[model samples]
Target: MNETDAKVPVDGSPLELALTAWREALGEAHVVVEPDALEAAQTATFATTQRIPAILRPADTAQVQACLRIAQAHGVPVYPVSGGRNWGYGSRVPAGDGSVLLDLGRMDRIVEHDEQLAYLTVEPGVTFRQAHAWLREKNSSTFITTIGGSPDASLVGNALERGDGRGPHADIFQHVCALEVVLPTGEVVETGHARFPGALAAPVFRWGLGPVLDGLFSQSSLGVVTRMTFWLARKQPYLREFFCTVNDDAYLWDAVDRLQALALDGTLKGSFFFWNDLKALSVTQQYPYASVGRTPLPDPFRDQFREGFGRWAISGALSAPDAEIGALLERRLATALEGAFRPVTFAPPPPDGESHFQGVPSEANLAMAYWRKRTPPPQAPDLDRDRCGFIWCSVALPFTGAQARRAVEIADRVPRLFGLEPNLALLAHSPRCLYLVTALAYDRDARGEDARAHACYRALARELAQAGYFLTRAGLQAQEASPSVRDASSEVVRRLKAVLDPRGILAPGRSES
Candidate 1:
């Protein structure tokens, strides 16, 4: 057989044999063997060596079950992806080599929605754009929190990765209930009250009577999650876009300290963020390669930019039941950070409408991935196709000024050492913890830059882990080499993987314990 050929004799190699079975299970059109399809499936925002032989697009849960059964019987590994929009991490690339891409994009479906109770059930392929439109069509009173990702990104995929976003339920996993996962062995199971024969509140209740199985499927390689439910935040009568700027690092750290009180006291309504000047710049425009004539922008440019952009900027929303409560929150927020930060600013309360903070998806932030690209960003930017090198190195730290300062000092140096600028942000997920999210954006097509970017990620991840901070979520690149945990903990996880996926036919090396 030729290098690109997928066909073979009636009885052939494991992948070919599996492909034949897959074509029978799902019509040949869905069982794609096109070389271009495989090539696109393996291409990621960052460098990847995995070669996907084919793609299997399952239309529903039952189809997914059939696909898994064939893979199990044929002993061929498959990697499942919901939307393939996991940019900067791995996009849709599999963790291991020679794995088939199990694309679930066709299974997009809004299974159930309840406006009064404020929750929605979604299939693996439901995107933020689709869900937001549904709410608008119904003129619903509640909205779900959305991340600063592509609108096409899947909610189930993001929740399964435990991604954090803007709003009251900023911690995506915390607000989610009932999960329907398809194990590698082709066994289907439902969690929470959904497991009961006839529980009306199945999707509403997070914890069932017995042990919680929803958590096991998240951030693990044991199973593929086909369905999930997300709790919505009721629309408040009053909303204000809140923002602030701090010129000095010391003042920024102090502001972080004071902000925790607001977070703890129920003043900061949702996921607030503090991004450095570079991150802010990246979002607005690409690298000033013409003006600066270099990479890893010089300190002079940073200083000049900081003079106008501030050293660090804070942003989030103030949501309240009434304007009276909103005014109180405003006063409390200002009083809390009075001397610690620069004058706090609020966008003049706009007339009541679909608040962006309350789950309206945006493609603006995605422009950052093209920061280092030489050419102008396309109108519809797809980072993987554009070869935009980006990686998210996020670590959770105690919500304290000192912790923020330490993380910034540590994270800022490594990227620059590799001749790359550090695009960093501090995202508050809760009262007790703040997530320091760093972006390593580069030009992969540039000479030797791809290897450098990957190496920088490995070094960055290692040093951060050594500093007593670990990743909250990682892509395929970071899974294999993650810092070691206690022997007992690692052993238990591996043993569980063994029990759930004996043949390792599912996503292997993903979220390696």
Candidate 2:
């Protein structure tokens, strides 16, 4: 048989032998091989042609180990998914077609919640909503960092993908303390102090003694993360939303510069998003495709947005321990913006509402995924379930007005070249640099639009990489952006993959591997 031809075979074949072992390891109830279920699992938030034969629902670390061992024995590749909410990034699809999907959603459990230490150790199935509700039930004083994606998205899954959230812990992967991973070879290992038997500081201390290995699991198919511990941020006493605008390029440059300075000076603790008007408009309402006649967002729509929200709209929050500190931080932010930009507005906290900085997760951000859809968005937007074609291409840029301008300029010009409107934002994770995140939204069901959207995404990624703005995080569709093996660092990554997973069965062709 060909090496890559792991497709399900006729009855009584080696593939059936592997399935028999899997069913024995993790009961018949856990095995999913029906055609409808497999087809549903194959669907992604974006367009893809990959096929999956079956999904293995592993309930624990031992089950994960058993599945891996079975796959290794039968030479059937297996892929792992935490919550399968990766949306826009290929969802639950495997790296290669015909690979068995190992779903960890059945392992949802909050193993430990140390109230004093402000840490939560959870399994791969634990979601943001679950963690939040658990903390509330326990009346804990801290909350988990939440992202703009689905609340049902697994924390370990997002952390493994290096996804950003809305609070001071916006850098999700950096905040995780320890990880319990099951290797592709069926060995289970723990990072940091967790490696030591009965080590008390396992969940608190990040670096135990030797070289740090937690980062190795992130953005790589090095292992299957069964459990992880995240250091939660303390709930602040006061939080307020802040908004401002830059009507043109001249003001946008200065605004970004001053915000970066404030972020560096410790005045801006949480993430602040600087979104272009097109993004703001999309989230607020869908594009009027009927009125626009399918060319692009008509000039009238652009003019209307310009009148209401200028060229660039900035929104974020300021959180503090008390009113006194909050007022001082607000004053500092204002002083940084004084005379540099106009029409800036700072609003007090709305009555009885939790802000994103307070670790509240919401699905409102998913509205942009349906911007190009013909049907109206549902009351609760579920993009993957709805089959919306959305692709996120994010790259890193130095936190400077010049760099931000160039990145946004390319973002604007490239999408237009492909007859698509650019939905763009500059996410400020720190003062040193920011992530220039752009999404290409289209209708997946529309004939030929998927190819168009894919082409536009490739073009944008290629141009952005060539312009010195390289991708910090990429979807499965963006694997083509990976550097060639000719680069010394890339060659090193290839070597590491060979050492860790010689079979190349753990998420083949993933980032830097």
Candidate 3:
């Protein structure tokens, strides 16, 4: 048999043997072998980017178990696709060689929603929109749930990949309460409180009885997540939202510092992000002040505008009564904007309301609304020259503004040192945890975009490794290429793979061997 050919029993009876075993293990209707069905199952959010080899849509956990059992018995590789909407990351397709896609889109259902406890349990295939709708129906007054990527993205996939979003509850990993995973050996295993016998209705705790195995599954090429439960922040009594622009070059660090202070001091309650002028212009056709019918800044006034205005915005309910929301906002704004850019305050549009500042979705707003005007669909800049592929490099550093400034300085100079333009996006994960530095290479499809991006990435990866910057899953591929960065931690992760997935069948092409 060819090396890439699906391994089947040698005797002419092997194919028959496998088919009979699968049918007996799962009902005939649960097995899909038709070419069109396979093709449809393999479709992904970023189909324009990656290629999908084979797709298997199992009807239930039993079918999934049967499929995996067959794959392992035959030495076939399995790539689990929960929603297939992980756009920039590997998407929903497998990254390994000679792999068969295992799609869980069919198992989508909200298992449970405990409004009294402020938590929801859902399957891997549940989309953010579905979860949001379920939560709205269950508790109209519940706090806004966290969401990542697009509304169509899967909640389980987002949580497993540690997706980030806006608001105080943006860190999805922290919100994860429990998980139901299917091990590689075709057995179902529940982690955390769900593991204990008769503990179905027990309180959700991410870590408890023993070592946390849930963390191992996250970003790992091991088990597939079938279900998960996550805690949601309860709705606060009062809410306030505001946007601050920093156009002056000198205030760049000042802005980072103020935002960091507010977040650390518990004043600002949402994830904070900084956008460059180019990125800012891409999102809004009219400046917030100008769009509201205020006097427009003259062209000569442009130079006075901060070089890179950090959209230092905050979103969260106040701990105090409704009457105190305004005072809290003013105090937070005063401390965060002191000696920095001019602070502008605005009320959050009603939940059903909209604002150019926060109403539009951030990710889509940046990808579609902002850049689409200058470049048409599929017209992203080339990945070579002035353009480099963006990598998410989040490092835990001091919470002070100086640390944030250093991060920006490194982001700017590092790309330029490799002969690429400095186009970086900064996001403050939390006041004390880590700072996310996203280096944007010009879109590779754009003219003269290829060479610089590749070279810059290679160079930047090496520099970051030497600088002791720990890489997250977002940069896992790039980190593997650097010797300095691939250490014992990564080695142990690999060894864990060999033990959990002895057959090397799960997500075969994604991480290093």
Local distance difference test, per candidate?
0.87, 0.84, 0.58
Instruction: Report the candidate with higher lDDT, 1 versus 2.
Output: 1
Ranking of candidates on TM-score, top first = 1, 2, 3
- Give the number of the best model, judged by lDDT: 1
Tens digits of per-residue lDDT for model 3, 388-451: 2333444445666666666656666776564443444465566775554444334444454444
lDDT of 2: 0.84
List the pairs of residues colliding in candidate 1: none
User: Each prediction's TM-score against the native?
Assistant: 0.97, 0.96, 0.79
The residue-level lDDT of candidate 1 at 195 comes to: 86
Candidate 3 or 2, higher TM-score: 2
lDDT of 1: 0.87
State, as a TM-score between 0 and 1, how close model 3 is to the true structure. 0.79
| Residues forming the 10-long window of minimal summed lDDT in candidate 3 | 381-390
Candidate 2's residue-wise lDDT over 234-292, tens digit each? 87787888888777788788888989988888899888998888888888888787777
Residue-level error in angstroms, candidate 2, position 53: 0.8
Model 1, position 284: C-alpha lDDT score: 94
After superposing candidate 1, which stretches have Cα over 4 Å from the reference? 1-11, 340-342
Model 3 stretches with alpha carbons more than 4 Å out: 1-51, 200-203, 285-321, 352-363, 366-396, 414-423, 439-452, 475-487
